[model samples]
Target: MPKTIIPFGPQHPVLPEPLHFSLTVEDEIVQEAIPGFGYVHRGLEKLCEIKDIHKMIQVVERVCGICSKIHALCYCEGIEQMMGVEVPPRAKYLRTIWSELHRMHSHLLWLGLFADSFGFESLFYHFWRIREKILDINEKTAGNRIIVSVNILGGVKRDLSTEDQKWILAELKEIENKLEEVKDTLFKDYTISKRTKGKGILSAEEALYLGAVGPVLRASGVAQDCRQLQYAAFSELDFEPVIAQEGDSFARMQVRYFELFQSIDLIRQALSKIPEGPISVKVKGYPEGENVFRVEQPRGEVFYYFKANGSKFLDRLRIRTPTFANVPALAKMLTGIELADVPVVILSIDPCISCTER
Candidate 1:
């Protein structure tokens, strides 16, 4: 059989991020997929040399717009650990609340895009509409819709008031109801199932071997989540990693779908048990040691490595994004799927090229 190589994206209608894949195809089925990157690389990590440690928070947030809060949180937490700062109890709960809200919005955005990938336009719009509520919550509470910039070195920059908490809970109830209405259409619809089920199947062993993270690893039944490490108020909350055995595109979608509700529940728990105190503590000195921190973002585990020299600038700031870890797994999943199924399968891991290239 003659082979053909197809270039899939750096730009495509279905891809929200810029990523290129050299897909070798025999007839309609993909034989091998070699990924190409560097389209949107901004050298974010390199900026740590020039930008002060405090300014790097805004820089890290730009690594990916969808889950910016998590990036900031990871960076701040790492720095705080090195500086030996104790975040106030209220600040920890506040950070957890905003982080989960970021998770909800990120998952909703991915769900909408996933629907669009399979030509479910109405479903896409429905998910995005629900996502707008989460964005609104970010804006009302943290002053930005996407990159909230609420996380600071020792804690959070903003605090949720009593009235704000009540209003947020009411809004979450509405979002939960909206999600219930679409549950059947997303999981039980014939078209969605046909497009997603059994497509891009990756085994649990393969997922771990390929270093998959976040929902991609969970969908393959590895039951690992950085949240289990209990950063922020996750230590005080209760939840389990959402997992499925199928390791297919549909399983990936299911993991993310269930995580939406889980994030909501986490927020509720944090707000209910939130203690009264200052949202942040005054920092007396600069970070001087080396530390590594990991946090569960909407997509997966984001790892941050910090090397400080007791100066205003960091010696090194290295970030290992979830998408970077999941890319090899994505390549593995793409090898045997049909060319027509490429978009959805690629989207299944929710590739964040900016994060990867950063």
Candidate 2:
């Protein structure tokens, strides 16, 4: 069979971000796939040198709109560690609550996009509708919907009041009920299963060798999650990593679908056990050394490296987003799959080119 090269992105109806993939196909089956980047670069990391460390918090939140709070959380925690500032207990719980809310919304957004990738338009709309509630919670509590700038160096800038917590819980309950209603369609629907099950199989070994993270790694039956690091109030919470053995598109969807409820449970746990105290602490000195921080984002583990020189501005800032780590696994999964299934498989990894290229 003669080989053909097909460009699969940079502007596809199914991709939420701009990601380009060179697909080499033989008789409509993918023989190899090479990913391309550099389509979206904001130079946010480079701005650290010019922007004050405090101002960079808002900048980091723009790394990826969907996982904004987690990015800011990772950056803030790294800076706080280097400065020897401990976050208040109440602030820690508040951070956890907001972080989980971000996670739920991100996953819901991905789920909706995933459904759309395979032509499930109604399912897509349904998922996004449920996601609006989570975004509303963010706007109500943190003062913004997507890029909620709630994280600060010492702790969180916003606090959830008693009435706010009650309202959030009530909203979450409704979201949970809505998710349950669509659970069958997401998992058992013939079309979804046909488009997802056993497609883009990335075995456990492939996942680790390719450095997969987040749902992509979990779907491969890896029980590793950065939340196990005990950051924020995760140390006080109890939950298990959602995993599946198939390591296919269906498995990836399953892991994310189940994680929606897990995030809700985490928010509930944090709110229930939240202690009363100041939301933020005063930092006394400038950071002088370098430190690394990792946080579980909706997509995967986001790594932040901070270098400081006892000055107001950071010397250097580096970020390793999960999409960058998962690109290799994506290429591996793409190989040996039918070209028609490309969109389904690509979206399965939940690529965020903005996060990757930034």
| Model 2 vs. true fold: TM | 0.99
lDDT of each: 0.92, 0.91
Runs off by more than 4 Å, candidate 1: none
TM-score of each: 0.99, 0.99
> In lDDT terms, which candidate is top?
1
**TM-score, predicted candidate 1 vs. hidden true structure:** 0.99
- The sequence of per-residue lDDT tens digits that candidate 2 reaches over residues 1-358 is 9999999878888886788999999999999999888889888899988899889988888888889999998988888888778899999998899899889999999999999998999998999999999888888988888999998888888877899999999999999999999988877899988899999999998899989999999999999999999998899999999998999999999999999999989988888899998989988778998889999998998998888899898899999999999999999999999999999999999989999999
Error of 1 at 133 (Å): 0.7
**Alpha carbon RMSD to native, model 1:** 0.8
